[model samples]
Target: MATAKDVAARAGTSTAVVSYVFNNGPRGVAPETRERVLRAAAELSYRPNALARALSFGRTLSVGLIVPDIANRFFGELARALEEVAAERGNILLIGDSSQRVEREHEHIAAFVERRVDSVVVVSVSDDPDLSAFADAGIPVVALHPLSESVNASSISIDYRAAAASATRHLLEHGYRSIALFNGPTESAGSRQHRDGFMDAVRDLAPGAAVEEHSTQIARAHAAQVALDMLARPSRPRAVYCATDEQAYGVLFACHRLGLRVPDDVAVTGFDGTEHSAYSYPPLTTVRQPIPEMAERAIALLAAGEERVRETVDFTLAVRESCGRHGTDVAS
Candidate 1:
């Protein structure tokens, strides 16, 4: 393997000039010298040492991303989007899957801090995730969910309450007098927002709508089990609004197991419009969070500085077969 010294020797330049050319640098190299270094590097296939650069510049040129459940389609897509954006910015993204465990989440946080990642993007399972570690280490954090002001971090998320309300309203428009809410297990800020939004929609738009709420782990199997019992009730809801597509999929499974037809017997709507949602049995109608846009903005904000800003992006309701949309008409 060729080294920077070999490239510099072939280019007839000092190692410092090579460093300036490769690092884009503290010191300027002549245009002609820069071209020479590039040509020699191409011939020698010499690669710069990332560790050496990081040691000198105090930046790993990497971002750490922690998600509650990587197996969930929503987080999987989010990770991919974040990785793309980070790569475009000349940085690598390190992903840590917490699997809904606080201890595991903390372990990832510590690992990132030890690795000296420039910043972190987190989707924690806890309401008040301990960010003091990152704060003390001077590593900025950007959460992808609703966070309290006391957390000492920035957050970028869509208005979950409003989004949830909108989805519930869609069911109401379909004349679903009885609607059920399938929310996440934990009582985090994000969960509260989902609950508030769901109730608000029922109160404001469908005052007479009979509403029932249930909670389950984000896993599809767990949600399926919870849904099986819910749908088996004599007073089962006509429509269900899920906090996530994962849960919605489980609801669909429960519906099938009970020999109930979708949109005919019961309708369902999901949050997080992942691509897989499109391919679900009945094509789920969902609230689409802008993953690419959110990822790009989050990366930009974290890379810029530790400016404690709470940002909200736009979300859209994707009308599809599951919600029983008539013609081109969609429930918003």
Candidate 2:
């Protein structure tokens, strides 16, 4: 309720001096004068107009984040890390969940453009998500997943194919000849990479291995429903390699419902090794994407205001109890 004029009147300084103090100024104020303005503001509980300052400076000091599935633990972790990085640079983060819908994603895109956010980071449901709205609005955008060449945006992620291959090979090494791959909902670039990596690993390591692929929405419940039927069959897979930690958890639930023990009746592996994965029943053998490092890099890149850059972060295969291992050690 207190205005700058009120504080200025109390401080015996002009409103321009208050502006200089609050904005850190186009013109410098003396230390004594600055102290008087601050004291007066504290007495009157004066607040500056952030929107007015942003309008004048052409920066909202906020970052927009769009995630495909907010309920998925992986995305939640990514958002948390991104939020921290954004906050460190004095930027508030605005999150939009698309729920794996392109229309929802586009709505968020349009909203971010309209808000005039300083930058945007997205994990789109589509490989070639149309970001022209943000592009036309001159807002720099980055994708956390691989994007098609036509998308016109920067991307930073682990090599999905390589990460998938690495996890699949680990399952193969444990001698899982009859394996199944649980993938994301569609045949997007990321899903294809996962499928390719899975098949490639099977071909190279276990040429005669039996393999099948199943697609489901990137959620625990949907994946569980699909797995419950497949896992109940007489010729169920000896092991399952999931494209996400969420799906892997679903398969674990299915196995539990069927009274099958993990790494004994069947082995399992997952991608996106979220922190909670470590506490799963048998623990989770997974590929750990560096969410914090990737988030830091993405935020820093946008803050740098340079040409958008394409970069690949590293991933590790975290060996744990979910997949049968040779030793008691549980580490990458």
Largest TM-score belongs to which candidate?
2
Put down candidate 1 lDDT per residue, 241-263, tens digits, no spaces. Answer: 99999999999999999999998
How does residue 183 of candidate 2 score in lDDT? 93
* lDDT by residue (tens digit), candidate 2, 1-332: 99999999999999999999999998999999999999999999888999788877999999999998888898899999999999989899999999788899899998888889999999988766788888899899889888777787899988898889888999898888999999996744389789989988998999999999999888888889999999999999999999999999999999999999998998999989899889998999898888999999999989987676778888888889899963332323
lDDT for model 2 comes to: 0.89
Question: Which candidate leads in lDDT?
Answer: 1
What would the TM-score be for candidate 2 when compared with the true structure?
0.95
Q: Which ten residues in a row have the lowest lDDT in candidate 1?
A: 323-332
What's the true lDDT of residue 329 in model 1? 27
Clashing pairs in 2: none
In model 2, where is the ten-residue run with the lowest total lDDT?
Answer: 323-332
Error of 2 at 313 (Å): 1.4
